[model samples]
Structure formats: C-alpha cells, structure tokens
Target chain A: MNRRDGDTCSSTPDDSLAREERRLGWTLVAPALGVVLLVAIAPLAWTVWESFHHHDLRMPWLGRSFVGLANYRELLGTPRFWASLAHTAFFAVASVSLELILGLVLALAMQRASRGRALIRATVLVPWALPTVVAALLWRFLFQSDAGVVNAVLIAAGVLDQPVVWLAGTVTAWVPVILADVWKTTPFVALLLLAGLQGIDPTLHESAAIDGAGRWRVLTRITLPLLRPAILVALVFRTLDAIRVFDLIYVLTGGGPGTATEPVALYTFSALMQNLRFGYGAALSVTIFAVAFLLAVIYVRLLGADDGRGGSTT
Target chain B: MDSLAAACRASFLLLVLGACGGGRADPRPVVTISGSAVGDEGAILRRQMDRFMELHPAVRVELRQTPDDASQRHQLYVQWLVARAEDPDVLQLDVVWTPEFAAAGWLSPLDRFAPEAAAFFPATIEANRWDGSLYAMPWFVDVGLLYRRTDLVPEAPVSLEMLPALARAAMAGAGAPGGPPPPAAGWVWQGARYEGLVTVYLEILTAHGGRIMDDSGRVVVDDPPGVDALTFMRDAIRRGVSPREVLTWHEEETRFAFQNGDAVFMRNWPYAAALLADSVRSQVAGRVGVSTIPAARGSGGRPASALGGAQLAINAHSDVPDLAWLLVSFLTAPEQMLERAEAVGQLPPRPALYDDARLAAALPLGVRVAREAVASAVPRPVTPLWSELSERLQIALHSALAGQVEPGPALHTAAADMNALLERSGLRYGMNAP
Candidate 1:
C-alpha cells in the first residue's frame, strides 16, 4: 500500500508468496485459536491469577487482597492436603494396574474365542457404556450393609457369620470404589489391547509352532512384545483419568466416615464450591494441573523413547 | 481494485444487517425465582405463581426448582450471583444461610419494604436479620419431631433414656414367638456427614445442656454435657438401639426405613408428618405419632430441637426488586401461610397461626407437638462461618459415632479448631468489619 517507500513485494516475488501463505494459514486457524482462548485458556489464566489473592465470596467483607504464595503455603502446611495427595496416588496406581491386568486377560479371551467373537467383544463393552455415576450408585447399593444382595448371598453361602460394613472402614471403602472403577473402565482398556492383539500376524504364530515353540514361549516372546505400545497408551490414558476421579466418590460417599477416601479433586471441590473459598480452591487446582502436566511430559518421553526403537505397530 | 471495493461494500452491508437484527425487546417483564421444593410443595408453589401471574398480566413469573440439598442450592446461587446474572430475581435461602448470604452482599436489604416483622415467629425473624437489617423474609418454619408407633407405645417418652426401652418393648411385642424376631431397627435419625448431621448433633447437644457458642462469640462446646451427648449417640449404635447402617442414612434413607415399618421410632423434620400419613406410601400410616424430642436424663434441660426452615430473599443483582418483593410478600402473607399449613402440614412461620382451629383440627397431634418443639427449638450458631463450622462439627460427630475418637477428645478437637479458625480471621458473627 505504501508504494512510495519501497516495493518489497516486487523486489522478491518468492518472499511475497511465502508471506501470503503464512497469512492464509493464520486466517484459517484464527477461529480455533479464539475458541481455545475463550473456553480453556482464559479460565485457566483467571484461576492462576485468583490463586495469588484472598478471594472468598462468602466473606466479601474481607475484601480480596494480594497475599502472594500465602494460600499455597497454608495448604502445604495442612495435613489434609498431603493425606489427600497420597490417597489420590494410591487410588490411581491401584485402579490403573488392576484395570490393565483385567483388561489384558479379557482381550486375550476375546481374541482366542473362535465362535461368537464379535458378540463377546460387544458384550465386553457393556460396562463401559454405562455412566460412571450410575455404576457407582449400583455398586453402592450392592455393598450396603443390611439389605444388599451381596451380603445376603455371602451369608446364605456361609462365607461369614455376619455381614461386613463394606463402606464403613477406611481401607475397605477403597475396595468398592476401585472395584467400580475397574468394572467401568476395564472394557475401554480391553478394546484398545484387542486392536493390538489383532495386529499380530498369523504367519508369526505359525512359524513359532513349526519351530516347536510352546504356547507360553510364543505368547511371551511375540504377543506381549508386540502389545507393548497399546499397553502403554491405555495405561497413560487410564492413569490420568483415575487421578481426577470426582463423580464416583461424590455420589458413593461424600469423602466421609472421617474423610477416609477423599481425593485431591474432591478436596478442591469442597473448598471451592461448598465452602466458597475461591482463592484456596484455585491454588489447589493449580497444583493438580502441575502434577498432571508433569505426568503428561513423562508419558510423552516414554512413548518417544519407545518410538525410537522403530518397531511400534500403529 | 474492483474486487476489493466489492468486498468492502459486502462487509459494510453485513455489519448494518447484524446491527438491525438485534435488540428486539419483549413488552412484558419476566421475573424468575429459584427455590427447592419437593413433590407437592413444588406443585403448590406453581399454583400460587400461576395465581400471581393472573393478577398481574404484565409480569411473567418463572419458578425455577433448584437442587434438593441445601449445600447444593448454596453453590448454585453462588454461581449465579457471583457472575451478576440478571435472570433469577428471587432466591429461597435456608435459615442458616441468611448470615452468610447477607454478609456476602448477595442478598438485597428489605428495609425499604418495612415488613411487618411482628407477624412472624421471633426466632424466624431473628434468623433473617444480619448486621441490624432484615435480609430475608420467613417462608415457612421447620423443627425436628419424634415419630413413634402409637399402637405399640401409647405414651410419649419424656426422656432419652426411656426411648431405648420403649423401642425395644415395641420390637419384642411385634416379634413372633418361635422364630427370629421381626426385622426392625429401634431409633433412626440422619447420621450421614452433611448439614443434617449437624442439626442432629445440635439437638442432642442442647438436650444435654451443651451450647455451641455463647453470646460473646466464644467456643463453648468442650464441656461435660457435650461429651455426654456424643457418648450417648455412640452408645445408641453400640447398644443396638440404632443400627449400624444409619451411618450412611440421610433424610431419604431414614424416611424409607421408617415408612417401610422397619423402624420403631424416627427423628425427622415436620415435612415427614404428611408424607408418613399418606396411606399410599406408608405402611404405618395411622400408627405414626408426633412428639417433642426426649431430653437427657438428670440434666433437666427442656425437650430440645433444631430450627430448620427456609426464607425468601431478593437477589441483589436483580433489576426488578419491587416485583420480587411483591412475590415474597404474597407468598409469606398470613393467609397463604395458613393455607399451606392446613393443606400440607407445613408449619406456619408465625406462632399465632398455631392456634387456628383449621390447623388444629386437620392434624391435632402434629400441630400440637410441632408447636411445642417450635416454642423451645434452638437455632444453630448464626455466623458467616457456619458452613465451615458445620463441616468441622459433622466430621467430629461422625468420627465419634464411627468409633474413630472418644467423645471427650472429639469435642476438644472441634473446639480447638473453631477457636483457631475464628481467632485467625479476627471477625465476629455480625461484625464483618475487617
């Protein structure tokens, strides 16, 4: 437009064309970038800002003031935070590991079945299809101390002389929660692993049999090694999902019987929504985001290392 | 050059068209109100709102049914009011929420209306006042009452010690001679870790002459009566007077157990009276009887109960405060209050309404018993920090009942926590000055 100063466009046609392409690319992505900023990045940035202040809605008389790092310092000193962190870690580790093993077993079973293989695969997905809240409620009813069918059957079979209060104890409370989670998500992991199971070539199995390889040898040497990528993917996904568990615990128990099964997410929700302490809740949220971010980085690095080995199948 | 000119003209036309298409305003003003009302209560509210709409044709009133839990309702209001949304013009607040909501400036002051404060119960009016100004209007009154199987126990037990024996006698009489006894629990109340649990603890504590805080805003629960009340609750489970499953029972669960004839006695709010008497839903319809909660032996305290009710408040951000006040006034007027009380067994917000022949004749036992309870019902500590305080009390009480801590130490820990939180903030109940 300012042709009097210099004509850069005429001086280099290639540079002008490249600049036009960059402009078109940014124009195409502007809407997506705007949506991301509005929906995700804006709220995240606001939360980070709020974490540095004392912003409690319920106590508005105590006007919001900048108390940098005070909220984080207070939270770190509180015992409940460390306890909830440990609980979240334990829950994620236990549930993800159980889901992985169970999922692998189910995947193998479905893969081996010659008759009604499709039906078996479809049936395995039924638990995963139900909502997590619904599944948690069902498990809660099943584990009820008095009128639960589980207690009735156990008693009728003489498994115990009396009914056990399944959700009343600290260690026992985690059992039903983990069991419900595993039941709901194991199918997802199985479906992922089943794809890997199918990816193994029939020729490889045939060759192993001709060499007189036993079932154990063929399975360990070929099947598992080929399934490693899928297993890693499923593990990372489920682990992250398990770390942010809130719905199941909220419905089944309100982190109760003396805060026995409270995870960090539930703790943050209680502080933020229930107590209306925005500043403290934001601090807790930032900490959780940091942990999740670190985990994601580690997972990506692991996958990158695996990819460098150059034998990953899809 | 021609293409660029054409593009500019097209963009200008589009902007003009967009501007003209917007700002189509409606002639009628819409007034939206949010509250939580169950089953018949919701229907009644809808009917009343329909009448109000008919009277004022230009004002369209929308009634929003919020979450059933009080804490959830608080969260919903916080979400709306914090964002300064203008849709919900009125809010129904729990009695205990008045202090917190008023202190937060989320509720508009009603001093301009000059409401007839003398028309309502003193305690209900007292609950609506914060910083020397009324922030809400009393909608209805609620107080806990004991429901007993009248066929088995002809007389109301005068003391807490008498309830265990009376419930056991009823259970034994109902049992068959040769086989296992009928499957029934003795006494049931809300034992879940929620706001209801705090109310239950307060009633039990006050029955044994324990106070939560004094007039000067001091923590006063670490006393002998507090420990005794807590120990009594734990003993109720240990002695098999109350079942272990009550640990997970809230209002719904306890209501189910009682209505199904699995419990001999239950402690519940006034709303349960009508629900229990509904023959379609209750097995012990005619047998249900209401009485004031029994007292602690030797302490000589009056029959204690917790004040539980809701109030109506105008949203501070509402654009139509006058219309909102009109709705509140119409809903809480004496005529409407008595109509609700006569129809659904809801206690009127005024003490004078208890003497009405219509209410007395409709439900003689409930009205009489609820009146007595309301006369002496104790209010939980009125403070802006009520939610946090209740959380601590709930955990302490739950831990004590679950056998995780001794009653004495639990009271001490709760008192210490309260003192630390209050002192650290350096703010009193009504003194919100920083």
Candidate 2:
C-alpha cells in the first residue's frame, strides 16, 4: 500500500477523488446486492445443495443423507421426467410461435387503425389482464365434453357429429392448454411489438412507397428487419415463461389424460409439494433452472449482437 | 422521520414479543386440532369442542381450520409435522396417510392410550394401524357404493356381468312405463387421473380378486386378475355402457350425472346420498338405492368397496399427547359420531352404530345398506409409499382408459415403476415396517 501510494504521490488528489467516488458507489449499491444475495442466490444455493441429498419429507425414517448425484441419476432414468421435458419443450415452441405470429398481426392492425384505437388496444389487453388461472378455467369450461360451448358450437355448425371429450384425449388435451396460454399472453407480445412499431420512422415507409416498393416488400424489408429486436425480446420473455408454465395447465387439465400435458414445473411441484420428495424435487428444479438459464444466455447473446448492429444502422 | 420509524419498529417488536409471551402463563393445557371446519362440519366441531371442554373443565381444546381438500390438508400436515411443530397437537388424516405418517414417526401410536380398536370397522381399524400399532382412530368411514335408480331398475345388479345388461335395460326404459325419461348413459364412475381414480380402480381390482400389493409387500397388480379388472373398466368405455366423458369425470361429476337422471348407475361415496336425496335439485331424488360393486363373474372374487374416510391422530411432537388423545377419543366416540352423522351425514366408523335406530334414521342411505357396503370395503395397500404408488397407478390406469395403451401393458409399466420406487426408497425390504 505504501509503495503504491508513493508511486501515485504526484497524482494523489485526483486518484483519491476517484477512489472516494468508487467507494461511495459501492456503499450505495451494497443494500441492493445484499438483497439479491439473500433472496435469489441463497435459495438457489440451498436447492442446489439439496439436490445432492436423499431427503423425502414423508419418508423421514430413511433419513436425509448426501447421495451425490443420485437424485439426478434417478431423474435421468425416469421416463416420466423425460416425458415432462418433452412436454415443456413442445409447449414452449408451440405456444411462443403461435403468439409471435398472431401478436405480429395484431400489432400491425393496431398500428394501422386510425379510429377507436384506444378502445381496440384496451379490449385486446383484457385477456392478458385476466389472471392466468381464471383464463385457463374459462377455457376449460369452453372445452368441456358435454355442455361446453366449444363442443356445442362445433356440433351445431356440423363440424362434428357429436360432442368430443376435449380433455380426455392425450393429443386433444393440449388444445385448451396452448390456446389458453396464447390467448392470455398474446396481447403482451403485441403491445411490445406495437411500441417497436411506433419507434420506426414513418418517413421510411413513405420513402419505400415512392421508391415503388410494394406493401409486402416494404413489410418484409423495412418493418420486419427493424422489428427484429422487439420480436426477439418478446420471444425470449414468452419462451422462458412458457417453459416454466404451471398454473394455466394446472387448472385446465391438471397435467392429466395420463400426464400427457404435464410440464417440468408441474412435475417439480408434484415431487416437492405433492409427493414431498424435497431432494428429487430440488434436482428437478435445478435442472429446469439450468435449461432456462441456458436459453436466457443464448437469447442475451442474440440480443447483444442485434443491439450492436441496430446501433450501427440507426 | 428516523425517530418515528425507530419507534414503530420498537413497538412492532414489543407487540410480537408480548403476543408470544402472553400464552405462556396459562395453567390449563391447550390442545389444538387441525381438520376440516367448513360449513356444517365447522359448526358441529365447535359445538363438540365446547362440550368436551365443559366435560373436562381442565384441558382446553382449540380447532385449527384446515383445507377441506384432502391432498391440500395432507401437504399442510406433512409440512407441520416435518417441522416438529408442537401446536396442532391433533391432525385429521386421510385413511391412506396413517401408515405414511406413522412410518415417518409423525404420529403418536395409540396403543399406549388403550383405544378400543375392535369397536371400529375392521378395515377402518386396519387402515389406521402401522407396524402392529394403531397410529390413528377412524373418526368416520367412507365406502364406495353402486348407486342405482330404483324407479329405473327394481333391484341392484347382482354381479359385475349383470351391471351392463341392467344398465342397458334401464336405458331402454325397461322398468315401469312413463317414468323419468331413460337415462342418456348407462354407468359413470370417477375415471379422472387422480387419487379418486385409484379408489375407483381399487374397487374393481378387488372385485376381480386382485390386490395392489400382497401381504408380503410385493407388487402383484399386473397379474391376470388386475388385467381383467382394467379390461372390464376399459370395455365399459369402449362398449358405450359407460360414456367416454367419464374419462374426465371425478366423483362430483358422476354424482351430477346421476343426480340429473342422466345415468342409470353411478359409483360414488356415502357423502353423495344426502345431496342426491334433495328432491328440489336432484331428478333421481326418490329413486336412488346403494349397493356394493358386485363381484366379477367366475373370478373367485367378491364384491368390494374402496375404503375411505378421515382419521384422527396425535402429532408425535405434540406437547400434550394425552390431551390430544382425549380429543381424538371424544371425537370418535359413538355419541359424537352419531351427532356428526345426524348433522353432516358422515358415516360412523363404528360397526355397532349401524345397529342403532338413531343412526338408521340419521343416515339417508339407511344403516343396513351402508353396513353391507362398509363390510365389503377394501382398504388400499397400507404403506408409507401409498401416495407415490397411487400416483403411478392413477396415470397408468388413466392412460389405458384414454386408449393410449393396452390395460395389460399399462398395469405392467405401473407395477414396474412402483416396484422401482419402492426399491429406490429402500422400502422394498422391511424398511417401511419401522
């Protein structure tokens, strides 16, 4: 310290001022860092630690013991675990893609509207505003086999000869689940895209028109290319949310029709809360976290590259 | 502003400390019981607690309201007992949970309390016992029954083979002319993939002479009897004797179908009898009758009803186990059971109660038929791993019913998975015994 101080003696005033500022910044951010460590990092660390143990709350007679990847090994071999992972991936891909396309169309419509735009936007937000569980329940009622409106309408319209048990079929059960997810979250995606649309220069569209670019060409070349960042953001958010989906599917189908629609989060919940296998549940949770984190990292990299190019272009 | 914040914090701390310390000085021992306290159940329980307190004049009993849903309550109790919480000295447990709780050492054995185990139905008593000790007392009993419309069919079907024919005839309006329009479906049961599905399957499985686990604790549900049972259920859905919609129905859904006179036969619990008898809401109000699910033909099997109900047990970590026992015994006594039956239509666990004329009058289903059903009742395998095993079985059964797999293959897979779970948990040996 004395040697460093001697070396910087000539620049002492400025260096000390910089050091003081750095210390003040640290002091200012300490509470937030503490909170992050306490709330987020601590529980995560505990779960990771628990994942290595053999702890079943309902089977305490076995005693909690360190098993060292045994839970993960068991999870890997379990068919139900693999099935649930596939279900999660299928749900995320299916729901997010549908949301993006529908959301993009909705955003374009909203942007082009000149009258009652506020009313249209507000009405579109209603589904998003409703709680996911409530929306899921609403969809469930609509798809019920006997008295559900969907079956009734389909039969009446001659689309079907009779009412189909929507939730009873393994493949058919995913309909309401995906439909509910898309219905509840598309508005948020559209709103994000709408904001992005507003950020685009209207003069760019006018110039494209003067240059003889058709509507489709302008949309494909100018609007879509510029809307890439917003689209990516919405994709990352919705995909992450979709991968960890629980309550909507929980209320709609309960991951049933023989666990056909069970997602990773619901599986973890059953192990943790229902079966009380804390150790196995922790392992399941850690695995889900790892998958979500990997996706996030990929999304962040894409966003970073897009931002750099976007900055250069603008 | 800082001073005011500091004063508020000090006051909050003082308030918490005061509240904690306030209850320490009471001379009378206070015992808390956690259970369903919803609607009439709540009122009856409070009245009983007051009466017990009056009788004792020493120990104070308190009711801690818990979720009415069995699984939710089980989760809450597991959390509390795992934490060794001394309050909620008593717990209301589902029938299948007693063994699990006892094995976990979360329940106090009632052998020391000298409970008269013989008074309760043997199956109910058997369900409450773990490792040669009674861990809980059955407070009430629930047994599955085949509810048929008397006006549609004069008598209950005598056997499983006879059910479809009888149901078809009833659907074709075979009984008296100009009765309620022939029901739309033939039979309905809880076929949803949950615990209720397991219970429904248990009745069928037993009727086909199959057991989930043998007395030696070996998984044998994939055997021929089990396959026959599953096939019978699947065929019901396939043959249109039972509606495919039943694949998504739970107890209440089936009850709704039967209550609306849309089904000729409905399998449900004793709780539905009173609700079905309400003429204002029920179309089959004056037309219902109850019987055990009949034995499958030539299977060497007998009629069986799945055993279910709530059991009361003292928390092993309780500060006042004896007081909790007092509460348990008081609640399970004939008087309280009769009161509960009269008030909420809960079936008493005691076999002798069926002989009581008052019980005959209290239960809308009548004691004789309830007794027969209870007599035929079969408890699900008593093991700490019951919930896990049941979950696997439920999924497998549901998958077969939904046509995702054959009944034989599904049960085989379930059996394999269940056995693996048992072995992995170190319960395949005699580890579960302790």
Candidate 3:
C-alpha cells in the first residue's frame, strides 16, 4: 500500500486525478465488500455473541443467559474434543501432502503429454466434477464388508481369506476416508498446478539441458522453484477443506465403530444438530475458524519467502 | 397540490389497514401437516388427504413430506420449533420424541380435544402421555419382532439361550438332503452408532428383565441384567451366531440382508414383513415368519419389544389449533389406519384393528404376531433430555458391542451421564436421585 501510494504521488502531477482513481477503486470493490459483510462477518459476529451464552434449543425454558467462558472451558477440557482435534489435524495433513505429491505428478503428466491431452485432462477431472456427497456415498458402497465389490475382489484374488470390516476399525477407517478424499481432490490440485506449469518459460528448460543438467536435476532446480506459488495456493485450498471435513466422514463412518474416526467438524455438527447445544457448537465453529486462519497466515508467509527467492515469474 | 399529496398518503395507510383486516376475515384456515412419506407411502397419504379434504372442505390441509431419515427429520423439526415458526400446524412425531417435545413446551396438550385413546394399544397411548397430559396422538405402532426362515428353523426359538445353538444347527443342515442352502448370516439387527441401536438394546435389555428407567422414571440400568444383556449381544458376535457385519448394520442393511435370504433370522419392525413377503423383491416370501423377541433364560415375563412408531402432535404456535387437531384426529382414525396397513403394511395403533376381518384376511399371522409384540412393547426412558440421554446410551451400547468398553462400565457411565444431565436441568424427579 505504501509503495502504491508513493508511485501514484510521483506519477500524477495533480492530486485530484489520484483521488478520483482511489474513489473509482473503492466503488468497484463496494459490492464485494458488502457481500462479505453480509454473508461472512455478520454471522461470525452472531456466532461470537452466541458462544458466550447458555443456549439449548430443547431447553428453551432455561433462557438465553450469559454464561461467560463456560462453554469454551468445557470444550477445551473434554477428551473427545482433543481426540477430534487430533483426528482433524491428521486428516488435513495426510490428505493435503498426499494430494500435493500426486497432483504434481499429474500436472507434470499433463504438461508432457503430446497426444489426447484434452481427453487425459478431462478423464482426470471426472472425480473432481462429481459432488462430494455422491463421491462419498460411492466410496461407502465400495468399502462395505459384505456386499461391496472391494472385499469381493480382494478375496477372489487371494488377498484375504475373509472380508475385513474396513469402517469398523479405528486405523482402517481412516485409510478408506483418506483414499476417497485423495481420489476426489487430486485432480483439482493438478488443474491449479497445471496452470502454473504453463506460466514457466520454455527457455529455462532448454538452457538447463544445454548446461548438461540431468532430468531430475532440472526438475528440482527449475520446475519446482517456479511451481512454489501454485503449490502454496493449492495447499491453502486443500488444507482448509480437509480441516473442515464433515460430509465424507459423516457418510462413511458416522464417527463410529466407537467415535474413533470422528473429526472435529462432525463433533461440532453433533453438538449443533443432534444435541441442539448452539452455544457450544458456536464456540467449536469459532475454534475451527481460528485454526484455519492460523494455517493460512503461516502458508502466506511461506509464499512470501518463496517469492523472494525466485522473484516474479508470471 | 399539497392536499392531493396528503390524500394519496392517507389512502395508502387506509389500504394497508384494510388489507390486514381482510386477512383476518378469511374463514377457511390452512393447516400444514408435516411428516415423512417414503416410497409408495406418499401416494397412499395423498389419497388419504384427498378423502380428508372432501369431508372438511372448510379447512385446507397441506401435506408436506419430510426427510426419510429419522435424525435428519428431527434436526429439521428442531430448527423450525426453536425459531417458533407456525407454518407446520401439525407435526408427525416419533414415539420416543414425545417427552422431549412436551418438555420444550413446543407441543399443545391434547386433553381438551377429547380424542379417545381407549381403542389404541395401551403402550402406544402410554408413550404419548407426558406428566399426565396427552401431547400427541398415536398414529401407527411398531415393535421389534424376530423374523426367521420357517424352512430353516421350522419353529421359533422358545428362549434367547436357544437361539445361537439353533442358528448353528440350521447352518450345519444347509447341505442336508432336500434342504435349502444356508444363509451366510444367522442373525442381524441395528447395531450402528445411532438411536436405532438404543431401541435394539432396550428390547434386549427389557427382554432380559433389565429396566433402564423404572416405573417412577428413575435411572435403573446399572445392574446385573443390564450387563448380562450387553454380554449377550457381544457373545452373539463372538460366537458367530450373528456375523461381525452386524456391528455396522442399520435397519435398511439388516432388512436387505434378511429379505435377500442371506440371513436365517432378523430383528426388525413390522414394515419389513410386507417388504420381505413381496415375491418380486424377496427370495424368502413364503418362508419367513414373525415371532416375539426371545426372553432371557428363566425370565417369567413375556419377551419384550421396543415401541417404534410416529405420532401426530399439534404445534403450540399454530394459528389454527382446531384445524390442526382435526387433521391429526382424521389421519389417525381407525379407517385411515386400516387403509394404510393394507396399502403399506403400517400397523395400526388401535389393537382392535388386529381383529378387523379385512386385515385378518389380508395378513393374518402378521396381525396376530404384531398384536402380541405390541402388548409386550416397552417404552424407553421418558425425559425432557431424552435426546441427550439416548445419545449417551448409543455410545455406551455401541462401545460395549464394539469391544471398546466393558458392558458394566459402559452402562454405569451412561447412567451417570444421564443423571448429570437431569440434575443440571433441575429435572431430578426420581427415587434414585439424592
């Protein structure tokens, strides 16, 4: 903002032109700002107010009285809350990191493919195009112990003597969940990184090859350096989504076989919808938002450092 | 010009007042009735509503189909009721939701309506009452009954202790000369982590002579029979009488497995009977039989079943309470109930319907068995914090069934949690309370 101010002051001889430019910019952004205030900020403020009160839909006669930090204190102290937080963190990190590596491979494939490029791209995007709920349901059917084709194929191929209840085990439940999420979202990350791959100059690869650089060396020093920004953007999008994961796990596990695979968002939903404890659920929502905000800030800082190292490429 | 502008403003104000008065003057009130109508049930309900509308043309009844899933429907109702919206004048309530809805002051007491409950099954009517006032009218009734293949078992097991040995023997006889192939599963029921698990557990617990909430509404499940009930379920899985997949089974899963002839026995509601008997959809159409859930060894009482059904209640905020009551009463009338029973296999709440000649001719065995099951049906704990208590119980029963917690500890923990919830809400009104 300071650099922009100095440039405007030096380039314009008259102050009125710069002032008019500023007014025009504000006018252009006014609609977007109004939308953000109405849809995001207003609800966030209401949630904040609600988090400090005693509110249960089924117990309306108790009245919506101020309860201070009681809800927060109870949530923080609960073992289930901490367990859910751990599950959410593991889900986010595992899904994002796995998607990043797989997505990068797909992005490279898309960049190098010389035939049927459109077909390959479209086929890769099919999973992403399907709705999350529908994809989750499909995966649920595939993982069922008795009727699902997964166990049927495995047993037929001598992979197992008996069918395994994939959703009943604490560790095994997460395997299907993570795999389903990766299958659905890796294409999205690939699309973002594919756009970044196109922005790189062909001369960089040509020059690296002329210098006798090997294929792997060229990839590490040149392709990866240019891809940092895209990777960061993809990471932010996927991480935020993974942290707020609810629908997939809700459909697949219903947080069960003993609440082993329950994520924090499902916990929040149980409090809100099932238990009707709005104040506690609001506090949970605020905590989740705060966590996402912290992760975004850290990623943005890393992005800035990456920019300084490579300078602007696009 | 000034007078003309003043005249326009005055006329606009008068028009607004006149519009408000005109709305109040309309006599034909619309009472919106909300409930779930899954599959062909919607068509039957529409026909029933058509008849209702013909009789009372002065009142227009708008029928709305809610989500098929019970939990989703409950959530939608909570959202509407908490906001105090009056659009849904009549609500279709689950039998278990009576205490919770009544305590919230969201449902209008129906004693003033003078709707008779004498013809209805006593247990169904008892479930509708809260604090000596009827908050809902029982529409249809359901009870958990053991469905088995008559070809395999030949006769229902007389006691719970005999089930495992009987199932094992039948499975062994699958390849016997002139015998049908044995199913992969011996027994299956709802065991996933939800309210359905609680109902299933309550049936088994009560059948074993365990009382969750005593007659005075006290917490009483932390006892020997409670532990024994949980152990019996765990043993079923461990002993291979019920497949391990039963842990993940809900109503639909169990129904699918049983109706497909892939299981020897199933514990499900009466709705499964008609579906299983449909020759087009099921392989066990002529072979399946409904029997009461088996009693525990040496228990003198009849085998217990959990009451499962939807009821009709008037929303307290309804603008036309009289019309809502009329719709509720009309929908639950014996004629309509019998029509639904013949059309969709819904069991009527009225016990006299079992003796109705048409119903007996259509499905004689089902009516007789359902009547017996309803007579022994035990209602779960009735409390304002029913949803909360039911959730804790689901966790308790599920954890024990999953081998994550011991039965004794699980039941004790659930009882403690329920007591804490009740005490926190200042609803301590039982002998067990301090």
Best by lDDT: 2
| Segments of candidate 1 deviating more than 4 angstroms | A1-38, A310-314, B1-26, B54-58, B173-183, B430-434
In order, the first chain's TM-score in every candidate is 0.91, 0.95, 0.92
RMSD of each: 8.7, 5.8, 8.6
The C-alpha stretches of model 2 lying farther than 4 A from their native spots are: A1-13, B1-29, B174-176, B428-434
Q: Model 2, range B1-434, lDDT digits (tens) per residue?
A: 22223335445534643665554666888998878776788899999999999999998887676656566667778778878899689988999999888988888889998999988888888888887888999998889989998887779888899998998887876445665568889999999878998998889988888889886777888999999999999999998999999988878789989998899899999989999999999988888898899998889889999999999999999999988998999999999999999998899988888889899998888888889988888988888888988999999999999999999999999999998888776765443343
Tell me each candidate's TM-score.
0.90, 0.93, 0.91
Among incorrect, acceptable, medium and high, the docking class of model 3 is acceptable
Give lDDT tens digits, candidate 3, residues B1-434. Answer: 22223335345534643664454455677888878654678788889888888999887766655666678778778878888888689999998888788877889999999979798887788777877788999888878889988888989998988777777887777533565578877888888888888888887887788888765555767778888888989888878888878778878889998887788889998888888888999888888888998888876435988988989999989899998888888899888988888887778888778889878755534667877888888887666678878887887787788778888998898888777777667665541121
Clashing pairs in 1: none
TM-score of 2: 0.93
User: Could you give candidate 1's per-residue lDDT for residues B1-434 as a string of tens digits?
Assistant: 22223335445534644674566476788788887545677777888888888988888887665666667667778888889887588898898998888888888999899999998878888888887889999898888888887766779898988988888887778453463445378899999888888888788888887788866777777788888888988998888888877888877788888888888889898878888888999887888888888788889566888998889999998999999999999889877887777667778888888888877866535567778888888888777778887887887888788777898998898888887877766676556221
Alpha-carbon shift of residue B93 in model 2 (angstroms): 0.7
Poorly placed runs, candidate 3 (over 4 Å): A1-31, A312-314, B1-28, B215-220, B299-302, B430-434
**DockQ of every predicted complex:** 0.34, 0.51, 0.31
Q: How do the candidates score on chain B by TM-score?
A: 0.90, 0.91, 0.90
Q: By descending TM-score, how would the candidates be arranged?
A: 2, 3, 1
